[model samples]
Each structure stands twice: as C-alpha cells, then as structure tokens.
Target chain A: MFVAWRDLRTAKGRFALMGTVIVLVTLLVGLLSGLTAGLARENVSGVTGLPADRLVFAEPPDGRSPSFSDSAVSEGQWRSWARRPGVVDAAPLGVRTTEAAAAPGSGGGTGGGAARVAVAAFGAEPGGRLAPGGLAPGRVVLSARAAEELGVRVGDRVRLGPGTAAVAAVEGDASHAHLPVVWTALQDWRRLPGAPGGATVIALTTGEGFTAAASEAADEALGTTALTVDEALAAIGSYQAENGSLQLMRGFLFAISALVVGAFFTVWTVQRAPEIAVLKALGASTGYLLRDALGQALLVLTAGTLAGTALAAGAGLLIGRSEVPFAVEPATVLVPAAVTVVLGAAGAALSVRRITAVDPLTALGSAR
Target chain B: MTLLLDDVTLTYEDGGGRLTALDRVRLDVPAGTVAAVVGPSGSGKSSLLAVAATLIAPDRGRVVVDGADTAALDRGARSRLRRERVGIVFQQPNLLPSLTAAEQVQLMAHLSGRPPAAARDRARELLAAVGLAGEADRRPHRLSGGQRQRVNIARALMNDPAVLLVDEPTSALDHERGAAVLDLLVGLTRERGTATVLVTHDREHLARADRVLTMRDGRLTGA
Candidate 1:
C-alpha cells in the first residue's frame, strides 16, 4: 500500500471529502438501526415477555394474516388447548390500550392533578400461570414507564373506565404496541370499556421439544392458529408496519453508501489511469495495482465507518435513558459498521476492476 | 547483446484494415553502449523500442531481452522479465503526482518487493547521480521539465536493469537541457554497462551515440 498510502496523504482534500461522505452515511445507518431496535422492543416486549412457548390466536377470515389486535379467544378455546397432549399450560391473556388517570385530588401523583396517561392493560387470572404474582380485583400493576408517565407511585388510587382502583405493586416493565402495560385481574379487565368479555389471546406453554407441526395440528383441532414467540410479534400491527419502514430506509442507506463510494473510486481510478499505466510499463504486476487500490479503499472505509458508528453510539448513550428508546448494543452499532465497510469495499472493487484493462503500452509512446 | 529484435513484425488495425507498424525489424544492442534510433513522426521508431521493451509482442519474429525469448514467455513471465532486466524512460516524465523525486525512484525498487525506506539511500544516490540531489523531496509539479525528465531517468535505473529503453527523454526540454540529458544517458550507459536504446527525431545530439540508425516508412538503416 505504499502508493495507496501516499496517494491518500497527498490528495488529503479529495480523500477527506470522500471520508466525510462515508461518515455521514454510516451515522445515518447507525441511528436508524438503534431506533428500529428500540421501537421493536417497545412494540413486542410484553408479548415476548410471556412465559409461554407459543401464543395461540383466533383464526382470521380468509386472506388475512393472524393479528393480536383483531383476535379474541374464549374460555372454551383455552380449556381445549390445556387438554392437548403436549400443552403443559394454557393461560388466557388479554391486551387493550386505554387511558389511566390518577384519582382527583390524590396525594400520590407528583403533578398535584389527575392527568390521563395512555396505557396498555394486560389481563390475566390472579396468581395466574403467566404472571405468577397475585393480582386481586380493583388494582392494576404499572410498568416503570407507566409509573413515570402518570407520576404515580404504589398504593395510589387510579381511575380506569368509571372505576377508581387502587394501584397494585408495579412489577415487570412490560409494554405492548408502543404503550406501557398495566397487568390487572381477569374480572376487573372484563369490566373495562371495549372489553370483548374474553381474553385476546391464549399463551401456551408446550412441553420440551415441541414441534410446529404438532402445534399446527392442535390449532386445527381447536379452531385457533398458533405461532412461536418470535413469529407472533409480526401479529402486532404497529410493529410490522413501523419495523418494515425503518428497515427499508436502512437498506437504502446501505445501498447509497456503496454507490457513493463506488462512484468516487471510479473517477479516482480513471484519473490515475496514466499513472497506473506507467507503473505497469515499469513491470508492476496487475495484482500489485489491485492490492493498492483495494487497500486504499478499505482504509478509507474503515476509518470513516468506525468514526461514524462511534459517534452514533456516543449519542445513543447520551440520550438512551432520558430522551428516547435507543439501544446501544453491539448489534446496533458494530454490525452496521462492518456491513458498511464490506459493502463499500465491494463497490470499490467493481470500480477498480477497470484498472486491469489499462494497457502498459499506452505508457510507452504517449505524451504525459 | 542485452536487447535484440530479430525479424520482428507488428501491425495495428486502422481504417478497416491492418497497418504494419514494424515490418521484419532487426536490431541488436550489446551491453555497455547506446544505440539511438532517429525517425520521422510515423516512421515506427516508437514501435521498434516498444517491441524491444516487451510492451508489444511482434506479430511475427521474436523479441529477446537479456537473452530470454519473450515470445515463449506468457504475459506474467514477460512482465517479470521486464521488471528484472528492462527499464523504460517514457516520452513523458509520467511521474505519479503523489510521489516526490526520491519516492518515484523508490517505487521501482518496491515493485521488486523491497521497502522504499530500505532503498532510500540508493534512491538518493541515483537522484544525485542524475544531478537532482537538491530536488529529491520535490514533486513533479514543483520541478522543472529537465529535472522531471532526469527523475524519470533515475526511476528507470532504480532496478539496475540490464536494458534501458528511452523514448524522447529530452523532447520537452531546451537545447542545453536536451544536450545535457543525452550526455547523462551516454555516461550512465558506459558507467553501468547497460544496453540503451533511445528513440527520438532530434539528430542534433548524435555525437554521444556509439552508433545511430534512421527509420523511414518502417525500415531502418545505418546513418
């Protein structure tokens, strides 16, 4: 990389401009990746947090995929699922998005006033198989986010659909469809407005080594469809649409980064054709030239990408807890950086392939 | 002989037909001498030098550089042969804009798998030999035309090749600088015992050549 290194140093402005472009593209990709993961976590954390191997939903009409928002299961379906051979446990779980307000003139809230906070309520039997904690009637468990948003602590009176209820202990931080979850007794949940008078979905705990084929057969026999926890997240309407859009944007950014890098190197290699020819005439091998070009590209991409990813990770850390739902894991930052470098290098390879076609003879008789 | 072209024939496609650039050309340059080929613009002087330099494989006949038949060797082998035994001074300086005077020389050594820093002393020596010692760190754009040409000459000699092919080294210089370049070529050829072939149209600086030949219409004769 002797020539490659020197070229980078000598043409500092040109390389710097290219490096800056890579940095910006990588930054955009990194931020999008973090946000995507954060939103996904918020959308499905409650469902994923279920201690069940599979989630059973009521079959939809023809030509429609299974969805949590549209599916409602009855007590008969849960009983039939519990009677299956491999089914160890079948618990009725209900999901509903509603508004929660602190009781008027309550001393529990920090704001000194009752404000309606958007919340998602998950209903289960008290000390049920899914939650395992005793949840009596007229009380609800608030996730950490719910507690913070409502400015309410334990032992507070909260109003939910014409019922002023005492707050049960806020336990696990669970959320569904971008809203904080409130776990309540099955009886109390049935009394809330818009309650379908039954559980939304049945969480199933299958024996070890459970197979999808067996689950399919059971679903057919019970007039219900079932999916693994990972697959069931797609049933959340918000998760599917939101995640798809963000992923598409990230894909475009990757492609654009490759194209931008490719275009820059294409023009650079074209400009250096004469120099390459001279080197060839001096008997520098085609392999040697290729290594130099590729090495230069890799160097630029690595530096720029790492810098951008670091910037994104730093920014994510700064606001991860207070401002927004940003995840700063290795998957969110480093993996995207590696992909950017590889794709950028691939683009550069395509552009620099033109170097081999340069004739060394052109270096001989021509004017410089 | 370090450079020999025997019955070499070369042609290029032109106007929907073949145009012969060199027709059965024959030449030999023994080690420790300079053989200058003078010709008009289209007289195939460059073609002859190119064939000898192994940049072109004649359509017929053979090119033997340092006693290796380039015809039998494959493309990769021919390139290696050029690196080990041949050096070419192009019509233009053709210096890489990124490299300085000394680094230009060192690049040739690097092609032979040696570090440029390891060969820095030799690069400085060669640059000093060519009277560009003071311009060692200057890039091509910073140097004068003659100095750039001299740097080109120094780079060609960096690998200590047995055969040195020069193409119009002084075309871009004044008469004095051109004469000085010619003198340097003659002196380097004698001192290093290298076989040198120079292609040029200028005959004013003919005294330094041990022998001179003229090419007209793809034919050569003693001058």
Candidate 2:
C-alpha cells in the first residue's frame, strides 16, 4: 500500500470529505438501531419475559393472523393442552390495556392525591410460572413502571375497574403495547368490564417429545395457533407495524451508505486511472494494486465507523437518562459499525475492480 | 543481444479493418550500447518500443529480452519479465503526484519484492547517480520538468533491468535540457551495461547513440 498510503496523505481534503460522510451515515444507522431495539422492548417485554416456551392463541377466522388483542382461549383449550402428550405445563394468560389509579383514602396515594396511569392488566393462575410473582384474589403484582406511575408499592391499594387490590409486589420493567404491566388473578381479571370470559392465550411448556408435527397436529385439532415465544411477538399489532417501519428505515440507511461509498470510490478510481495504467506498465500486478486500494478503503471505513459508533453511544447514554427509550449495548452499537465497514468495503471493492481493465499501453506515449 | 525483436508484426483494429502498426520489424541492441530510432509521428516507433518492453504482444514473431522468450510467457509471466528484466521510460515523465522523487524510484524495487531497507538505499544511490541527490525528497509538483524526467530515468534503472526502452524522454524539454538528458541517458546506458532503445523525433541528439535507425511507414531503413 505504498502508493495507496501516499495518495491518502496527499489528498487529505478529498478523503476527509468522504470520511465525514461515512461517519454521519454510520451515526444515523447506529442511533436508529438503538431506538428500534428500545421501542421493541417497550412494546413486547411483557410477552417476551414470560417463562413459557410457546404460546397457544385461539385461531382467528380464515385469512387472519393471530393477535394478542383478538385472541381468546377458553378453559377447555388450556385443559386440553395441559393433558396432551409431551406437554409439561399449560397456564391461562390474559392481557388487557386499561387505566389504573391510586385508591382514595389509601396511604400509597401520590402526595396524598389521586393519580391515574395507563396499564396493561395480565391475568394468570395464582401460582403459574407465567406470572413474575404469585397472583392472589385481592392482590396484584405491579411492574416497576406501573408502581411508579400509580405511586403504589408493596401493600399499597390500587383501583382497577370496579374493584381495588393491594400491590403484592413490584418487580421487573416489563410492558405490553407501550403500557406498563400489572399482574392480577384470573378471577379478578374476568371481573373487569368487557373482559374475556376465559383468557387471552395459553402459555405452554413442552418436553422433548413435542415435535413440530405433533404441535401442528395439536393446533389443527384444538382450533388454536401455536407459536414460539419469539414468534408470538408479532401478535402485538402496534409492535409489528412500528418495528417494521423502523426496520425499513434502517434498511434504507444501509443501502444509502453502500451507495454513497460506491459513488465516492467510483470517482476516486476514475481520477486515478492514468496513474493506474502507469503502475501497471511499471509491472505492478493487478492483485497488488487491488489489495492496496482495498486496504486504503478499510482504513477509512474503520476509522469513520469507530468514530461514528462512539458518538452514537455517547448520545444514546445521554438520551437513555431521560424519558426516551434508547439502548446502548453491543447489539445496538457494534453491529451497525461492523455492517457499515463490511458494506462500505464491498462497495469500494466493486469500484476498484475497474483497475484490472486499464490498459498499460496507454502509459507508453499518451499524455498524462 | 540483450534485447532482440525477431520480425515482430503488430496490428490494431481500426474501424472495420486492421491497421498495421509494425510490419516485419527487426531490431537488436547489445549490452552496454544505445540504439536510437528516429521516425515520423505515426511511423510505429512507439509500437516497437512497446513490443520490446513486453507491454503489448506482437501478432507474429517473438520478443526476446535477456534470453527469455516473452511470446511463450503468459500475462503474469510477461509482467514478471517486465519487472525483472525490462524498464520503460514513458514519453511523459508521468511521475505519480503523490510520491516523492525517491519513492518514485523505490517503487520499482518494491514491485520486484525487494526489501525496503535495500530498496531505499538503492533509490537514493540512483537519484544521486542521475544528479538529483538533493532533490530526492521533493514531489513531482515541486521539481522542474528536466528534474522530473531525471527522476523518471532513475526509477526505470532502479531494478537494474537488462533492457531499457525509452520513449521521447526529451519531448517536453528545450534544446539544452534535452541534450543534457540525452547525454545522461547515453552515459547511464554504458555505465549500467543495459541494452537501451531510445526513440525520438529529433535528429540532433543522434550523435550520442552508438547506432541510429530511421523508420517510415512501418519500415526501418537507416542504421
């Protein structure tokens, strides 16, 4: 990379311009990745945090996908799954979005005043693994955010629809459809107005004998749709649409980065065509020239990506301290940086391949 | 003979037909001597130099450089041959703008897989030999036209190639600078014992060569 190194040093302004573009693009991609992951966590953390391996939903009508808002599984379905071969356990789970407020005349009221907040009510059996803490008839488990919003801790009374329950425990920062979760007893959940008769879905755990075919056969016979814990996240309508849009934006950013890098190197290679022919005539092999060019590109990409990732992580750290959800982990930071480098290198490689076609004879008598 | 072109013929696809660039051209240059070829603009002098440098393969006949037959070699082998045995001085100095004069000369050694320490020393020695000792660290934009051409000559000789093909080295210089460059070329040819082929349009500098040849219409006559 003797010539390549010198070229970069000699053409500082040009390369700096290109490098700045990469850094900005990488920064955008990194922040978007963090935001996407953060939003997804808020949308489905309640479902994803369940201890069950799979979820069984009441099958929708023809041509409709299963949805958390639309699915309603009865006690018969949960009992059938619990007794099926290879099934270790099955528990009924209900999900509903509603308002929760501090009960009046209770010591847990915020500043001795009433406070109301939106919450996702999850119903489960008293001792089921699907509940974070044990549920009881007159007590509820409030997620960290729900407890904070309602100003109610353990032993504090909170009013649900038509009833009031003490906060049995406050644990985890789980949410569903962007609302904090509040775990209640199945009996208490059904007492709410317009609540489902039985449960929203059935959480299940299967042993080794539960093959894919068996699961399919069981789904057909029981009139339900079975999905793995991860796959069931799509059942949240808001999560599907929001996550899809963010992912599409991220995809477009990647494509734009590749195109921008490709365009920069295309013009650079064209400007150096005469020099390339001269090098070829001087007996520089095609492989040597290619390696030199690619090495230069990698150096630029690595530097720019590192800088961009560092900046994004710094920004995410500051943003995370506020109300906005922004994650600053390796998956959010390093993965985007790596993708940027690899894609930028690929773009550069395609552009520099034109070096192979430059005719060495042109360097003989042609004017520079 | 260190460089021998045995009845080489080359043609190019011109429009719908073939244009004969070199027709049955033969030339020989022994070691420690210079042969000058003078020609009109399109008389194929550059073609002969290119053929001798292994930059272009002839349609018929063989190109022998330092006892190796280039026609029998593949593209990679030909490139290796050029790196090890042939050196070409282009019509324009064509110094890379990013490289220093010393780096320009050192690049030849790098291409041949030489050690950096040795290549650097050799490059300095060649630059001094071409009388650019103090100008080694300067880039092409900082040097004069004649100085740049001298760096070009030093670069071509850095590999100590057995065959040196020079193309209009003095085209961009005036009479005094051109004559001085020609004198330097002749002296270096004899001093390094390289078989040199110098192609030029000017007849005034032919006296410095051991032999002079003339080309017209793809044929050579005077020697």
Candidate 3:
C-alpha cells in the first residue's frame, strides 16, 4: 500500500469528500433501520409478548388471511380444544382497542378529571392456561407504556366503559396496532362497550404429539378455522402495508448506497490509471496494486462507517426516548453498518478490477 | 552481466492488419558498458528497449536478461525478472507525484518485496551518486526537470539490476542538463557494471557510450 497510502495523503481533499459521503449514507441507513424496528414493535409487540407459544386465529373466508379484527372464536371451540389429547390447555382470548379513562389523582390529572388513553385490551379467564400472570375480575394489568400515558399506577382505579376498575400491575411495554395493551378478565371484557360478547380467538398450549387431524376435528366440531401465530401477522391490515412499504424503502436505500460507492471508486480508479501504469512499469504486480488500492478503500470505509454508526446510535438514543418510534439495538445499528461495509467493499472491488487492464507500455513514452 | 535480444520480432494491430514494430532485431550488451541506440521517430527504438526490458513479449525470439529466458516466462515470472534483474528509465522521468526523491528510489526495493525502510541507506547513496543528495526530500513537482530526471536514474538502480534500459533520459532537458544526465548515466554504467541500453534520437550523447547503433524502419545498423 505504499503508493496507495501516499496517494491518499497527497489527495486528502478528494478522499475526505468521498469519505464524508460514505459516512452520511451509512448514517441514513442506520437511522432507517432503527426506526423500522421501533415502528414494528409498536405494531406487534403485544402479540409477540404473549405467553402462549402460538396464537390460533379463525381462518378467513374465501381464501382471505386471518385477522384479529375480523376473527371470532366460539366457547364451543375452546371446550373442544381443551378436551383434545395433546392439548394441555386452551383459553378464549378477546382483543379490543378502546379509550381508557383514568381516575382523578392519577399523575397530572385534575380533580374528577378523566384522562383517556388508547389501549388494546386482552381478555382471558382468571388463572386460565393462556392468562398472562393470571388476571382477575375488576382488575387490569396495564403495560408500562399504557400506565405511563394514562398517568395511573398499580392499585389505582381506572374506568373501562361504565365500570370502574383497579390496576393490578404495570408490566413490560407492549403495543398492538400502535396502541398500548391492557389485560383484563374475560367476563369484564365482554361487558365493555363495542364488545362482540365472544372471544376474538383461542390461545392453545399444544404438546408435541398434536396433529393436523386433531385440529381438523376440533375445527369441525366448533365451526371455526385456525392458523398459527406467524401466519396471523397478515391479519393486521395497517401493519402489513406499513411494514412492507418501509422495508422496500430500506432495500432501495441499501441498493443506492452500493451503487453510489461503486460509482465513486470507478471514477477514482480512472483518475489513478496513470499511477497504476507507472507502478506496473516499475515491476509492481497486478495483485500488489489491487491489494494496495483495496486496503486504502477499507481504511476509508471502516472509519466512515464507524463514525456513521456512532452518530446513528446517539441519535437513536435521543429519539427513542421521545415519540419518534425508533429502536436502538445491536441489530438496528451493527447490522446496517456491517451491510454498508460489505456492499461498499464489493463496489470498490468491482471498480478496481480495471487495474488489470492498464498497459505498462503506456509508461514507456516521453509523455506519461 | 548480460542483456541480449536474439532475432526478436514484434507486431501491433494497425487498421485491421498487422504493423511490424521490430523485425529480426538482435543486440547484446556486456556488463560495465553503455550501448546507445539512436533512431528516427517510429523506427522501433522504444520497441527494442521495451522488448529488452521484458515489458513486451516478442512474436518470435527470446529476450534473455541476466540469464533469465523471458520468452518462456509467465506474466508473474516476467514481472519478477524485471523487478530482480531489469531496470527501465522511462523517457519522461515519470516520477510519481506523491513520492519524494528518496521515496522514488525506495519504491523499487518495495516492489522487489524488500522493506522500503531497509533500503534507505542505499536510496540515499544512489541519490548522492546522481548529485541529488541535497534534494532527497523534494517531491517530483518541487524538483526541476533535470533533477527529476536524475531521481529517475537513481530510482532505476535502486534494486541493483543486472541490466538497465534507459529510454531517452534527457529528451525533456536542455543541452547542458542533457549532457550532465548522459555523463551520469555513463559513470553509473561503469561503476555498477550493469549492461545498459540507452535509447535516444540525439547523436550528441553518443560519445559517452561504448558503442552506438542506428535504427530506421524497424531495422538496425551502424554499430
């Protein structure tokens, strides 16, 4: 890398400009990745955080996908599933998004004032197999975010529809469809406004021996179709569309980053063609030249990417605390940086491949 | 101690046909002597230097430099031959813009897989031999044309090559500077015992060489 290192030092301004571009692109990718993960959490953490290994949703009609909003499981379905061999437990679970009112004296609330917070309430029988920590009647378990937004803590009386209730506990942060979650008794959940008076779906704890035949028999007896948990993600219409579009945009950004890096190195290699020819005439092998150029590129890429990753992490730390909906984790930060480095290196390698084509005879003339 | 081009022939593609650059050319230079090749433009003087330097493989003959048969060597072996036994002085001096006078000389050793820093003593000695001892730290852009050319000569000898092929080393300089460069080339050829081939269009520098050959239309005579 003797010539390469010298070239970088001699043309500091050009290399610096290119480095800055790499840094900015890396920053954009890192931030986008963080925000994507954060937004996804807001849309699915509630379902993902469930204690059940798998969520069973009623199959949609006419070949449509299962959805929590449209799915309704009957009590007969739950009974049939509970009685089946290899089915250790089965519980009817209802999900509903509603405006929650907090009692006065909760933090930041005036006397007799009501603070309404959006929540997706999950209902289950007290001590039932699918109950998360065994929720009971007249009491609700509020997710951390829901408790914070409603300014209510454990033992506080919160109103749901017309009835008043006490907060059982404040647990992990979980959301569904951008709304925080609340756990309540199944009977109390059915009394709430807009309640369909039936379970939204069934949560089953199936043993290893559970078979499709048994599921089919239960479905037939209960007159309901079933689907696995991962297959149920399509049920949230807004989540599917939003997540897909964001992911596509991220993919485009990655592609654009690679192309931009490739183009820069292409022009850079052309500019250094004369130098390469001179080196070749001086008995430097093509392999030596290629390694030198690639080493120079890696130096620039690593520095730029590290700076960009740090900036993204700092920015995410700040934005995550606010309402920007960004997750700051290793997957969100390091994964993007790693991808940028690999793709950028590949682009640089493509551009520098032209070095092999340089003719040393060009270095023989009176005008190099 | 040996540089020989035996009945070499080289051709290039020209307008969908072939153009002969060197036709049945033969030359041999012994160690400790400077053999100058004087020729008209387009007469394959440069082509002969290139062939002798192992930069071009002839269509039908062998270039043996310091006992290495270049005709049978692959690209890597040819490159190694050039790095180890052959030194070429380009016509334009062709100093890398990023390297200083000393670094230009040191680069030859670097290309030969030796530590550049380990060759510093020799680089400084070569620079002093070329009378650029006071300008060792100057970059190509900072040095005058003649000084840059001297650095070029010093760089070629950095690896102690057995054969040196110099291509019009003084073409870009004035008469006084050109004569000085020729004098230095002659002195180095004798002192280093290298088989030197100097290509030039000017006859004024021929007095410094032990022998002179003239070329026209890709053929050689008047040794």
DockQ of 1: 0.57
Better of 2 and 3 by DockQ: 2
The pairs that clash in candidate 2 are none
My TM-score estimates for the predictions, one after another, are 0.95, 0.98, 0.93
* Model 1 CA deviation exceeding 4 Å by range: A104-113, A132-134, A162-164, A366-368
Q: Grade the docking of candidate 2.
A: medium
Give a tens-digit lDDT track for model 1, residues B71-125: 8998888888888799888888999999999999998888898875778999999
Better of 1 and 2 by DockQ: 2
Of the candidates shown, which would achieve the greatest lDDT relative to the real structure? 2
For residues A211-329, write the lDDT of model 2, one tens digit per residue.
88888888999999999999999999999999999999999999899889988998999999999999999999999999999999889888989989999999999999998988889
Per-residue CA lDDT of candidate 2, range B1-223, in tens?
A: 8998888889888899998888888888999999999988888898888889888899998889999999789888988999888888888998999999999999998888999899999999999988899999999999999999999999999999999999999999988999888989999898889999999988887888889998877787664
Model 3: residues >4 Å from true position, as ranges?
A79-89, A103-113, A205-231, A366-368
Global Cα lDDT for candidate 3: 0.85
The residue ranges of model 2 lying beyond 4 angstroms of the native Cα positions read A107-113, A366-368
Candidate 1 CAPRI category: medium
Best DockQ among the predictions, by candidate number: 2
lDDT (CA) for every model shown? 0.87, 0.90, 0.85
Candidate 1: the clashing residue pairs are none
